[model samples]
Target: MTAGRPAPAGPVWDRPEPPSRAALSPLSRERIVAAAIALADADGLGAVSLRKVGAALDAGPMRLYGYLSTKDELLDLMADAVHGEIELPLDAGWRETLRALATGIRAAALRHPWFTELAGGRPNIGPHALGVMEAALAALDRSGRFADIDEMMSARGTVTAYVIGAVRSEIAEQQVERASGVSEAEWRTATGPYLKRMLATGRYPTLARFVREGADRSAEEWFTAGLETVLDGLGQ
Candidate 1:
């Protein structure tokens, strides 16, 4: 009965359209995570911040809040995304399955060094990370070597501990090289005289022998040898 209100304009849906605005690509968690990954890859984990990530994606930091609540969440996404790069083998023997997982993780860590920095401290419960863990546990269970689930989990933890420690060592060596602008060989050569002097004191016979006779293995070879030793221990 309030006829003076002009029928309430027949609903807002009947209103005329406003001028069109420029169309921008919609934001997504994937995009945000990807942007953060790229930043970490380029400049290391310290370089990654929500504002920088948002700038990388051409969005404001506040806009990213809709997709993730905190930078830690974004990092968890990035870590899982890196995990997604690992290839899960099919129908392989237990040893082969574990080898594939370990090597795939190593490869991924080499590509994204920041990943090793976040590897153990934070809980990686994302889907891809969980998939990798699931694959390893299943392989361990199928091997029938473990006495029980407890032993199986222990084996998994041992292998993971080795991998994370080994990869962190590798990445640290790499960072040292990158920072010093000196290759490992170059550094060894530069320090050769000092090392020789120290070794001459006879305080490090084993190490001196190692320095003289150690096999000149690449990083990959070292990683594989260590991994194989761990696998053998698990087998026994």
Candidate 2:
């Protein structure tokens, strides 16, 4: 309390060292992309950003610049990372392999709804994506049904396009159900009257038949049926 004369120091235990900041988690491109995917999964694709990813990873956004140059690159990384989840059939024939592969992609899209908006949305030359492409090429060529590059590419393009379109529809329905706060069955029941009204107009005879027949299938069933038809056409 008095002037500086060298006061007695407190006990070592009483004057303990101050706690310092905890160490930050290790940073890498995989960690960054994984954090972004987690954010996107919890919230949505719109929620993913460099700042949020950094926060999720306990690192500053600037640290990610070394691995991901820009937000676009981050998105590509996230997309390709998801592509790594697909289950490819190694020894199956072209039709079976392509069918399984496409179904797997759709399943992955369902698992990560954001994937529907990503895969093939850009020039995905990433390794996992390229690997999938390579597998598809090998499967299609293994049939020996396709003579050359053009045929092979066309077959691959057709299946790829089909998978993308089918998954887009699946994602759209899911988004609608999520936004409406209702399951698909509930939403359909809620709108049954309007759909019936629209069908009753007689202008949509085919639509009326579909509604009246109530011929329906699960999303997976529908996708499989459409894929079988496409494969049939291609084989023929």
Candidate 3:
């Protein structure tokens, strides 16, 4: 089995047959997940009530209960569904591998901003999530230089947490833009004078410099710099 393969839920040979596209009468997990993803994409994660999902699929809410036990279960499935969208390379160097993993995760989170909110609500150890975890661990193992297993594990957590925190901040910024109709750059432009005036009070020259410099850094530069700093820290 591959390092990231999800645990055998059941015999592969015993897997249930998928419903035909023409078989409108058959309700399956894939259809249910698609409906949930659409509802989430359209209205955000909080809008994904079982009833709403069922309504989107033209089924009664009670009918969904037979397939998904509760809203939590549905969310778990939804989180995994979002994870399944991430693609990993079969071969890469250690830094390239880790960078790819981080980039893929960031892309996935951006594509499904709802998934970040779901992460807080659900205890997601689903297949795709496991695959991500396994892939990161495998990459570190293949690096062949870590002194302690515990240290390696801790470094991995730190790397992932930093990435997730950055992604969450970006998502929040985007959500604010959507709701308030203010571009981030516009917000910065509006606030910059007030912030600079406050900082010029001189108690925090370092912070003032950062704010000024940060204004000049493009979003990509900020993200790349942060990721590189984290990688450098891990090296030490």
Candidate 4:
């Protein structure tokens, strides 16, 4: 008999029809996680309920229970999966290492804005998260300035904090865009009367000059400049 192909009396397709969940291979934890992440990416984390996730994966919500005891565990898995996308550093030197690490994490958060919400929930003590931290800390350790573990940990904290702040700023920009329905430039224009009113009061001469001289500057430019200043301070 020909392998896979149906008999002469049957359909020509060799493959069996994909089965319903009742007859299908059981849904695994990995399948649940991938579905949840897809849901998050498509419709934000708020849309990633158990039922919705299961629907996306073609499995019953009850099937997810076998893998995840609660939605929280699923969230944890989702967060770790996002972190996994942040490829670990393969090169040396603390500055290069820190820059690459921070940039990669920032990109990941940008890719999945929901990850930012997960960052504050728990100490990411999972293997994947731990390994990322360890890689970064190890690079910093090679610098030898951090004689004490606390100091090294603090330094690591600063870098991660910086990335968190950057991601939050990104989230805020999206929120502002939705709420204001105006570009930053348009916002400045719209708020000119208020800015002028404050400046005319004579209490904000410095701010007045700044507003006058840099009225055309974009909020994004200001944010980037501020972030660079922060990184410079951390490097120093």
Assess each prediction's global lDDT (C-alpha) against the native: 0.84, 0.81, 0.74, 0.74
Question: Quick one: ranking by TM-score, best first?
Answer: 1, 2, 3, 4
CA lDDT of 130 in candidate 1? 86
lDDT of 3 by residue, 105-199 (tens): 78888888877776545346888877876777777777876777787777777777777788888888888898999998899899988987899
Highest TM-score against the true fold, candidate: 1
lDDT of 2 by residue, 96-188 (tens): 888988988988888888887888576576778888888889988888999897899899889989999998998898788788789977877
What is the C-alpha lDDT profile of model 1 across 26-60, one tens digit per residue?
57777878888888989999999999988887888
Q: Model 2: how far is 11 from its true place, Å?
A: 59
lDDT of 2 at 109: 85
In lDDT terms, how accurate is model 4? 0.74
- Top candidate by lDDT: 1
Runs off by more than 4 Å, candidate 2: 1-23
Residue 126 of model 2 has an lDDT of 72
TM-score of each: 0.88, 0.85, 0.83, 0.80
How far is each candidate from the true structure, as Cα RMSD in Å? Answer: 10.4, 13.5, 6.3, 11.1
Better of 2 and 4 by TM-score: 2
lDDT of 1: 0.84
Clashes of 1: 0
